[model samples]
Target: MFHLLLVIIYLAFISLGLPDGLLGAAWPSMYQEFQVPVSYAGIISMIIAGGTIVSSLQSDRLTLRFGPGRVTAVSVAMTAAALFGFSVTRSFLPLCFWAVPYGLGAGSVDAALNNYVALHYASRHMSWLHCMWGVGASAGPYIMGYVLSGGGIWNTGYRCIGLLQIALTAILFLSLPLWRDRPGNGRDSATRQEEGGGAGDPAPAVPLSLMQIIAIPGAREVMVTFFCYCALEQTAGLWAASYLALHEGVSTEAAAFFASLFFIGITAGRAASGFLTLRFNDTQMIRLGLALILAGILIFFLPLGGNAALAGLIIIGLGCAPVYPCVIHSTPALFGADRSQAIIGVQMASAYVGTCLMPPLFGLLANHISISLFPFYLFVILVLMFLMHERLLKKTRR
Candidate 1:
């Protein structure tokens, strides 16, 4: 039963990742069809991000009312619907309308699943689940690329992915029973407090309110850590292809394919990290990741051309691999399992906000100054993330 739940959670993470890379890959064709400026993509992105933020903030309420399994199933259904909408939309305005549900679904699933794994599973599974996410995210662009190569319309790509999402949603509905049969599923409820663990522990029977969660020692720092880390990760990903083509003089097709190495690195690195967990604690793993991220940025800035940039992106991917899962897995240890659901929800929102704001802001700067500054931008974000995480560790210890 536990293994079955793990399989569902892993598949859920893959679904979470599927849409994330779709827009970027399909936008070149989509904008052409809609007769809109390529920059118009940001509007849809912001709308989705806004919706995600709203839903993520309310995840605890939804999870409390419906349970994680139902929340995940419903969220995936919403996203699947939105993706279908994207496939059928003939113009930009309809696409904007659909993005609302897309973002909301993404956020709810992200918050619900992360908190569930943090509570019920071992730390290694967190890294492996995120690795599964990387697989889906990486597969998205490949699916679109295949469609484009076969002379299919951009909508065909969206349609294919949407259909895949629908199938997963059906599977989710069928698997809802697995969650109910799991142990300790109701432990966080006040009604279950007497049967739950000891009193006065960090994870109380009653969940913390948002304000109360933030009032905990290191809460603000962890929020900052999430924001900075996501900002660094997303910025590197969104800009790497452009940075390579424009800055390193790589061919567009080659750059696009090579740019995927960032995610590939993340996927491979997480598999490696799961093994490394045998020797390293969470803090040690994070510190090692930060060091690799810094090294990757430095390599990225070197004038050695496209090959160096590819190597840098891969190294950065390796660095990013462990940071997210490790920080998330530590939430229960940092505060308590009682507060984890709320904390993880807010963390998802904060991370999405970074993903929403930073990439575009960097684009503005990249437009004004040159794509060459991509490495510099990532370097600054990496430094801030490293410092904030260290502070979080210190505060949690004290």
Candidate 2:
């Protein structure tokens, strides 16, 4: 049953990722059909991000009240409905409306499941589970592309993923019993025992207010670290092609294909990191990832040309693969398991905040200054993240 639950959780993560790439892949066709400017997609994205932030902030309370299984099931169902809504929308307005639930569903489930796995599972499982997400994210664009190439509308692509989400939602609901039947359940009793609690002691993990969570030692540092990590990741993913085309003089088509190497590296790297976690701990994995990111950035600085930029992006993606999962997996240890849910909730919100803000900020800078500043921008964020992780280590150790 425990393994079954793990399988279900993996499927849930995949569902969580399925919609992420859909919009970006379909937006070109969508905008033309709706007669909207290409920029309107950003508005929908912002709406979704706003909803994600709000729901992520609420995840601790919701998960505590309903349990992760219920939260996961309900959130997946919400996204399914939202995707279905998107499938039938003709105008841009309805798409924006649907983005609300789409975002809300993603945030709560992300926080709930990450915290759940962090408390209940090994670091390797965390890495593997995120690898599943990358698989789903990669598959989403392919599905959309296939639909478009097959003469089906973008709406058909949305409908296809919506159907998949609905199926996963049903599986999650049926597996709710598995969640409760597990020995540890929500807050692992063994963990509490290790923390000096008796076997029969009541669970100490009450939902914490945002302020209360922030007051914990190392909480601020971890949040800033998450923000910085996400800022760098999203900014790079968003602008890599443009930077290659504009600054490196790569052709637009070639740059677009090369940019995909970043995500491919992340997906493949996570698969490898899962195995590596058997030897290296979370902190070690994070340090290795950060070091690779630094090396990748340095490669970008070398006067090697467009090919070097492509190589740098791939290396950077490989570096990113371990950092997110390791940090999330370490949350229960760095903070107490009792506080992990709330802390992870805030961490997700901070990540989404960075996702929403950073790419656009870089766009503005690129417009006024130069796209060549991309590596410099990533370097600053990477340095801040590295410093924050070091600070987090000290604070948690003390």
lDDT of each: 0.86, 0.90
Residues 108-216, candidate 1, lDDT per residue (tens digit)?
A: 9999899888878878898899999988988888899999999998898999989988999999998876765234544345222323335554443444577987898
Candidate whose lDDT is highest: 2
Error of 2 at 308 (Å): 1.7
Top TM-score hit: 2
| Candidate 1 wrong stretches, greater than 4 Å | 180-186, 190-209, 248-254, 301-306
Model 2 CA deviation exceeding 4 Å by range? 181-205
For candidate 2, give the lDDT.
0.90
| TM-score of model number 2 | 0.95
lDDT of 2 by residue, 1-398 (tens): 88889999999888888899999999999999999999999999999999999999999888766777788899999999999999999998889899999999999999989998998889999999999999999999999999999999999999999999999989988887677523544465423433445757876556789999899999999999999999999999999999999999999999988788888898899999999999999999999999999999999899999998889999999999999999999998888776788899999999999998899999999999899999999999999999999999999994
Among all windows of 10 consecutive residues in model 1, the one with the lowest summed lDDT is 188-197
Question: For model 1, what is the C-alpha lDDT against the true structure?
Answer: 0.86
What C-alpha lDDT, on a 0 to 100 scale, does residue 89 get in candidate 1?
97
